[model samples]
Target: MPGWALALPIALLTLIPVAAVIGAALSPQPEVWDHLIRHVLPRVTANTALLMLLVGLGVLCVGVPLAWLTALCVFPGQRFFAWALMLPLAFPAYVLAFVQMGLFEFAGPVQSRLRDWFGSSAWFPEIRGSLWGTVLVLTMAFYPYVYLLTRNAFVTQGRRALEAARMLGESAPRAFWRVSVPMARPWIVGGLALAWMETLADFGAVAVFNYDTFTTALYKAWFDLHNLGAAAQLAALLVLLVLVMAAAEQRSQRGRSYQVASSHCQPIVLRGWHRWVAFGACALVFAASFAIPIVQLVLWSLSTWREELEPRYWDFARNTVLLAVGTAFIATTLSLVLAGVRRRHADRITAWVVRLAVIGYAVPGVVLAVGVFIPIAWLDNLLIAWLRPLGFEGFQILKGSVATMLLALSARFLAVAYHASDSAMQRITRSQEETARTLGLGSWGLLRRLYLPLLRGGLLTAFLMVMVDVMKEMPITLMTRSFGWDTLAVRVFQLTTESMWENAAVPALAIVAVGLLPVVLIFQRAERIQGA
Candidate 1:
C-alpha cells in the first residue's frame, strides 16, 4: 500500500470538515462579513481575549501556590487537601456559573437577604453580568486543570532539585521561582492551554451571565438568526486560535521530558507558619472552589419546586446518562485499542495515529462539533442522493441523533482516556513484555495477563474523566441533540435562558449528582496508585 493509501482515510475525514468550513467562509457574503467586522467581531474578540487573560492569571495566582504547598508542605490536613483540591474538576463550569449567578444576581438570595437586613439601601458589590464575574466563575471551574498539572510536575520533580537549590544558599521561595517553576512550565502551560480551550468553548455560562464571546455569538447566530454559515466561520476562527495556541505551546516545550529518579521521592519539610499558612490557603481554596458552590447549588435546589421531577425532566436525565455512558464507553474502547496497538508495534504510523486521535482534546467542543457536523451532513446528503438510485429513501441518522453527538464527544474527549492509558502503559516496562515473550506469551497473552491488569488504574481514571466530561458537555450536545431528546445539560441551558432559575437548579444538581460517583472512585484509585 502507498503512503497516501494509508493517509487517505484520515486525510479525507479531516478535509471533509475543512472543506465545509471553507465553503461557509467563502459563502459570498461580504455584507455579513462587513456587518460583523463593523459591529460584533471586534467586541467579541476583545472580550474573549480579556477573559482568557484574566482567567489565566487568576488561575495562576490561586492555583499555582496551592499546588506548590500541597506538593511540598506538611500542612495540617495536608493529606486530605492534596486530593480534595481536585474536586473543582468535578464541578462543571456552567453549573458553577449558574450557582454563582444565583447567589450574586440582584434578586438572588444574597442581595435579597442584604436588602432585608439593611433597609434595602445596602450597597452590596455587584457580581453578575460583568467581565469579572465571568472570570470568577470560569476560574473556579478551570483552576483545577492548572493545579493538577503543576502539582504533578512538582511531585515528579521530587525533593532533590529543590534541596540542591537550598544547599546553594537559595531561599525556599527564591529557589522555587528559579528552579521549580521553570521545570514545571511545560506541564503548567499544557494545563493552561486546556483551560484556555475550555474558556473558548464555553457558551452556557457566558450566555447565562450575559457575557458575549465568540462562542456565545456563534450560538446566537446559529440558533436565533438561523445563520449556520456565520456560526461555521466563527467556529473556524476558534479552531485557528486553538491551533495557534497549540503550536506556541509545542514550541515552548521544544525539549522537555518529565522524569525523576526514585531516590528523590522523600517529601519536603515545612516549618512554622509555612505549615499553618499552607493549611489556611488550602482551606480558603476549598471554601471558594467546592464549599461555596455546593452550598449554593444545594440551597437553590431546596428552595426550588419539584418541577424537575416531571416526565420531561426524566427524559432529559435519561438522555444525559445515555450520552455520557455511550461517549465514555466509545472513548475508552478506542483509546484501549490504540494504546494496545501502539504497545505491540511502536511505529511512526501508530504514534501519529494516536496523536491525531488525541488532538481532539485540544479542539473546543463546539468547534469540533461544527467541524464534525458539516462533513457528516455533506456525506449524508451525498449518500442519500447516491443511494436513491438503489431505491433507498432519505437516510441521515447521524446528523441529529445520539450517535452523532456521542461521536463528536468521543472525538473531543478521547485524549483524557488516552492520556490515562498512556501513563499506565509507561509504568509497565518493555522488559516485562520481553520476559512474557520469552515465556512463550504472544501479544494477546501479554496484553490480557499483564498489560490490562497493570493499566486498570488508568482505565478507571480515563472512564471517570470522560464520563464527567460528557455529563457537563453542552456545546456539541446543543448542536446535535434530537428535538425531543434533551440532555440535562441542554435543559440547564434552556431553563437558564428562559429565566427559570429554579428549574435550572434541578438539572444543575443532577449534573452534580452524576459527577460525584466517578470523582470518589477516581480519588480512591488515585490514592492506591500513588501509594504504590
Candidate 2:
C-alpha cells in the first residue's frame, strides 16, 4: 500500500483545519504583529504564564500531600476523601466559574447575607473577578488530573522502598521527600502536564473572571474585531506556549521509568498525628475543590422558580445526554480500532496518523472548530455540485447536523479513549495473544474473544471520560450549533452573558450533575477492579 494513502485520511482531516487557520493568519492585508507587540499579546502571554504557574503549584501542593497521606496513613474516611477529591474532575471549569461568580459577585447572595447581618455597606470579602478567584476555580476543577495520577503512583510505590529508607535512618517525612517523590516524579509530571494543558485551554473561567489570557484574546479578535487572521495569529501564539510547556514536561520525564512492583510489598499503616493530619488536610481540600461547588450549585438550582423551569429544558437535557453518549461511543470505538491497527502495523505512517489524531486534545476547541469547518463545508458544497447532474437534491454530510458535532467530538477526544485502551492492553500479557494465535485462533477470533473482554473496563472508562468531556464542551458547541438548537452549555453561556446569575445557575448545575454520572460509574468500576 502507498504510505501516503495509509496516512492521508487522518493527516488530511487534522491539518486541513490548521491550514485554514494559517491561511487566515496570513490574509489580514498586513499582520497584526505591531498591535500585538505593543499591547495585547505581551499582557495576555504574561497572564497565561501566571495562571499556568499558579495552578501548577496549587495542584502540587494539594494533590501530592493528599495522595501521600491517603496512600500511607489510616485516616478516618481516607478512601472516601481519596475518591471525593477526584469528584472535581467531573465539574467543568466553566460551571465552577459561574458558581463562584454567582456566589461572590457584589450583589450575590454572599454579600446580600452580609448586608442583612450587618448594616448596609459593612465589610464583606471581595473574591469574585479577582486573580485569586480565577486560580481557585481552575484548581478546584483541574486538580483531579494531578490528584489521580499522583495517588496511583503513591499506591504503587510500595512499602519496601520506604522501609529501606527507614532502615537507613531516614524519618518518614524525609523518606517521602527523598525516596517517594523522586521515584514518582514521572507520574507527577505527567499529571501536571495534563493539568497545565487544561489550564491553558480553559476559556470560560478566565473569560468570566475577566482575566486576560490567550483564549480570551483570540475570541475577542474573532468575534469583536471581525478579524479571523488576528484570531489565528493569537491562536498560533497560544500553540507556541503549549509547545514550550510540552517540551519542558518531556525534559522533566526524560530517563524516568516507573516499573511495576517486583513483589507484593505491604504498605505502612498510620498512627498518631499522621492519621489525623491526613484526615484534616484531605477534608479541607475536598471541601474547597469539589463539595463547595456542588453544594452551591444545588442550592441555587433549588431556588429557581417553576415557571422558569421550561419543559424544553428536559429536551435540552436529553440532547446533551444523547450527544455525549453517542460521541463517547463512536470516539472510543474509533480509538480502539486505530490503537490496535497502529500496534499491529508498527509503521511510521500508521503511528504518525494515530499520533496526529490524538493531537486534537491539545488544540483548543475554537481552533478545532475552525479546522473542522473548512473541509466539512467544502465537502458539502462538492456533494451539492455533484448531485446537480441528477434530479436529486444537494447532500450535506456534516454541516449543521449532530453528525458534525460527533465528528468533532471524536477528533478532539480520541486521545482519552486511545490512552485508556492502550494502557489496558499493555496490562494484559503479550503471551496471551501469542498463545491464542498458536491455538489456531485467527486475529479476528483472538481480538473478539480475549482482548475485547480484558479491555472492556478500559474502553468503558474511556467512554465515560469522553462523555463527561462532551457534556462540559462549550466553545465548539457554541460555534457549531445550528440555528434554534441549544444544549445546557449554550443555555448557561447565554445566561452568564446576560448576567442572569440565577438562570445561569440552573443549567450550570445541570451540566455538572449530568456530567458526573460517568465519574460515579468510573469510581465504582475502579473499586471493583482494585478489589478483584
lDDT of 2 by residue, 136-189 (tens): 888878778777777777776667888899999999899989988887888788
- Candidate 2 collision pairs: 17-371
* Candidate 1 backbone collisions, by pair: none
List clash counts for every candidate, in order: 0, 1
lDDT of 1 by residue, 216-309 (tens): 8887877788877777888778878877988888898887675654543356578787788878889988888788888777776887747568
Once superposed on the true structure, which residue ranges of model 1 sit more than 4 Å away at CA? 1-19, 26-28, 167-169, 255-276, 383-397, 424-461, 521-532
Give candidate 2's whole-model lDDT.
0.77
Candidate 2 ranges beyond 4 A from true positions: 2-8, 23-31, 116-125, 257-274, 374-401, 423-458, 521-532
Scored against the true structure, residue 65 in model 1 reaches a CA lDDT of: 84
For candidate 1, the TM-score is 0.88
